[model samples]
Target: MRNVGVREISRRTGFSPATVSNALNNKRGVNKDTAETIRRMAKELGYERSEHLDHIRFVLARKTGKILDEGTFHPGVIEGVERVAAQLKLQTTFTTIELSNREAAAKQAFEITHDMSNGIVLLGTEMAEEDYVLFRDPQAPLVVVDGWSDRLFFESVVTQNENSAFRAVTYLAEHGHRQIGYIAGDYRIKNFPLRERGYRRAMREAGLTIDSKWRVVVGTTVNTSYDAMKEWLSANPPLPTAFFVENDIMALGCMRAMTEQGIRIPEDVSVVGFDDLPYASVCNPPLTTARIPNREMGEIATHRLMDQIREPRDYTCVTHLSTTFVERQSVKFLQS
Candidate 1:
């Protein structure tokens, strides 16, 4: 006899694995009618979740699919969580919720946390402050990773975005580059805006006048951003001597666009990127980027979650980690 589980229930009912998991776990978003049907099918199949091992559930919430779907940082985060949870002998469950539909998303969250007894780690990558408020119930221990809620501070571990972006841009200034540009991504996330803020602040402090047209906004994914950058280049907008992109993925896209257009990097225009992802080092000219400790962030977040579970606290806190600036051959140092 085989052990029937969420997958079995999903296959029988023609529902997604996430929906089945949520329905079985007493989570919300499934209409009452749908829930009842799923529960009946689960019961008929004699589905039973393994209870021998303690479980760490992760709810990856996103306002849109662009950042969560395309970015590579989440794997490191999940890996960190797995490493820490494994040491404690707890199994893990991963689920994703889209916040584009705010009402439905809130309903889904409330249903889970209201009756939830276990600790859940939320991947708060593309979540906003209002979006954060939806999961503010104290019924369960919640830890956040890769993002933070400032007003309603939660137990979160996130890399420093604003400060890192500021440093990256300032470094360009130190290399005698005054006409610095910015490659902004259209991912509606907390980190993206923070990084742009850092870039703008650095420019101001460096006494560099930013031409509005020099800042180009592109899509989230590599292909999309590449095309968008190419389109921006076609518009014949004034180009800056250096560019600071929001993340490494977008940085690569913009670089590819420039490279294809017969523009030489460093020699023609210096570039700096954030999130020093794997391919950053391997890319031609190698990227000068701010390295985010994604794996460490995951490990720290899990340890923090364990602490929160063991010793429930009166108030929750957000943990901010600093980023390391990785220098490479991408940026050109002009003579002062």
Candidate 2:
């Protein structure tokens, strides 16, 4: 069979040669969908996998239950990883780690990949400082997806949390909302703190008062967040004109709480959320949210891991992708 180069595939798919090469090599710069399309084209053209390429292992560290069960975020990211890996003609494996037993899990993960030349992609936003130490000196290359750490130096790909949150809050402010509240998630996740920081910064910029009563921290899940918001609403604390929630799931939960309390959405309390998950559009009042490119982040992280595997580097960097704002029915515009 004749070998089909990346350029031919790029021409066929309308992707750049670099993007096609990245997809074919299992590198991280291409989006999952584009990479998959390129891979299909390459396969049709008889592109073969190079024996020089190392296999990939995706290590999912879960603070909650399984990553798939947690929410649409992680699953979407995993889908991107799989699609890109398939295009690259690279072998991939998945392993789930319980955060409660991170030390043991990390050790086991290290042992499993110690002798192999495979690279690893660690997916989890809740990874603690100690959890990262286990993979610090793994003989194989590693990359982190949907999470970041200042303490560790692994190459990472994460959403632009701080800026995205700032934009979400600013959207509310622009709509004549000066009294904006925040529905936050557990701060243990690195992204949450960054988002909170952004929310605070935006509120300050808009000359809005940061009311402590309106800022509530709830568990990460939708159900837990719903219960927390319900309890918070019972106190009948002074409500803000608008709220910037950490994620769509939490936003949906808070909306449910508001409805149960007979508070009409957009009329009584306008709300905005982050991570425009699938349910964001289907909710009773479609969510106004900042869309995180989860799958794209996964694709880019995979490419970066491949680079690390090919060229072992002492220094590491984190890549942040920008978010887009999606306007929906959740936030009500007020007279300016």
Candidate 3:
């Protein structure tokens, strides 16, 4: 008969909990002979370190609650990470900090991580370049998701922001749409800018003139997007035949604003969005959008971080998972 857990082994070995943990994780500061003794005692006590460790610490960084709250893209990524970790018989834990105070958040994260024997997967969705620089180094191995930096590089896994946005916009062009507008959430994450770049590139490649007035930047949430779009519509500006919005939530809000103004979806303005959220399929008229493989990104980041933990890498790698363009009823075909 064998018991599972760390404290039991710690008590029997006459070692502090921290020493037991450090020895189990193969972390330094524990004397080599003492660590070996602890391991022997752990084995005798039937403490399965593989099941308890190979662990990862997930750090959710938030600049604001606007996008980091429940029911958003980040949760899917977390689920993916957890699912893979379980398959490997590894453990997962969480910590959160506010990027609103960059220095304090960075310092807090570093201090907390100092004692951790696990690698970290940072939720970089809302992180800016300056924030990235501030957290460029940590006491533990790190992987970042949904964000990247020109100045700093970590083993990163991100969505194919530019490719997906380009595909969405190009789909509109193929449907005989020359006048395509853009809608984006107002935020400081790296994803939005890449999505916008894809939109711009696609428009240019298609030889379609981008109407500067058609580009609207609104709040990151559905309510704020709705309010902003509604206010913009109140001005009675001419609407484009189609729009490629930043994400499904913002798309829904913009859709509501348009419908309220007597603008028929697909009929008046065909629209495409990114992130095929659950609501996309059930909406009044289904939204045609690019589905980001959020969970896959999270899983990959975990694996990558684990690899680094197993064998330290001198060079970092970045992985960008592509999206699936889901065609629904939101876009209407036209003839020139």
Candidate 4:
């Protein structure tokens, strides 16, 4: 007969308890050799395990239960979570929440912890302070991707928006472009604010003039951004040679607006965008944007949440991942 606890397995197999748990859970960060040895020992000891079903049963008994479904994914963020869940051989459940009312959304999120222990993933915008309060006791594991609350109330996996935006602007400046324009996202969102600050800081550092006409704050929707871009292009006679768009969605809108005006990308006006969504590569002239590690970010978020579930943390911790610049045909090199 074999012992089922992680400590017993660790002692029998000469592996750490963490390694034993990770191997049993099929999580990353454990050495293959160690995991294999632990598994072999379990098999030798006739330690019959009931597969993920047993774990699922345990999870279901928790007061905070969640279904990992399409409900959490918003637009570009869904594919990554779907891939991660598939890789984990987990069936996800989807639930929808309207962001306009934080209380309603929080209530829905709160109820998920009651009978589903699969954990919760927030794949859209960050949660509000009031919303975070709903999970103060955390009935189950919770992870936030591509966004963060005021504090690390829950585990988060997100790209470094501020640094990425800073680097994007620096790259443009290095390429000798000074007259830059910006189409920003909602100011209420923390990630967008960081990105805007990065863009402004980079511009000021380069000693370039940031024309008031060059900056526009568009709403969260792509259509909203498109209308704002069109208005700006129509109202201003002098358009900047280059533009920095907050996300690929907004960039698509700006692209349409610019094309209607008969401006060619990189030739008449250059553009850089964030998020590097799937369509970014297929754009007329592939967009030169910052690539986000969406899949890896999702996977990490899952693991982090699991960690919190296995061993509840005293406080929340934030993890910020970096982004890379993908040079495409969208931006033109302006030689001085």
Top-scoring candidate (TM-score): 3
lDDT of 4 by residue, 131-228 (tens): 55555444446677766667436677777888899999988888889899888765355567788888999999999888987887765455666787
| CA lDDT, every model vs. true structure | 0.82, 0.79, 0.82, 0.68
Candidate 3, residue 290: the lDDT equals 95
- TM-score of every prediction relative to native: 0.81, 0.81, 0.82, 0.73
Per-residue accuracy of model 2 over 82-173 as CA lDDT, tens digit each: 88898889887888877677667756765643423566788857676676766654445677887766676778888899999998888888
- Cα lDDT tens digits, model 3, 1-336, are 463455566778889766877788777799999999999987777766331234777888888877767346888888988988888877888888888886799676655444335777888877877777656544467888888777976888888999889999998998899999999788746788889999999999999999899999887788999999999999999989999998888899999999999999999999898889989999979999999888888889888876876776568888888899999999999985
Pairs with steric clashes in candidate 3: none
Worst 10 residues of 1 by lDDT: 110-119
Best by lDDT: 3
* Greater-lDDT candidate between 2 and 3: 3
Q: In model 1, which runs have C-alpha deviations exceeding 4 angstroms?
A: 1-53, 101-104, 115-117
Error of 4 at 39 (Å): 37
What's the ranking of the predictions by TM-score, best on top?
A: 3, 2, 1, 4
Q: Is candidate 1 or candidate 4 better by TM-score?
A: 1
Candidate 4 — which residues are off by over 4 angstroms? 1-89, 101-103, 124-126
Model 2's alpha-carbon lDDT is 0.79
Supply the TM-score for candidate 2.
Answer: 0.81
Which residue pairs show collisions in model 2? 27-303, 28-300, 28-303
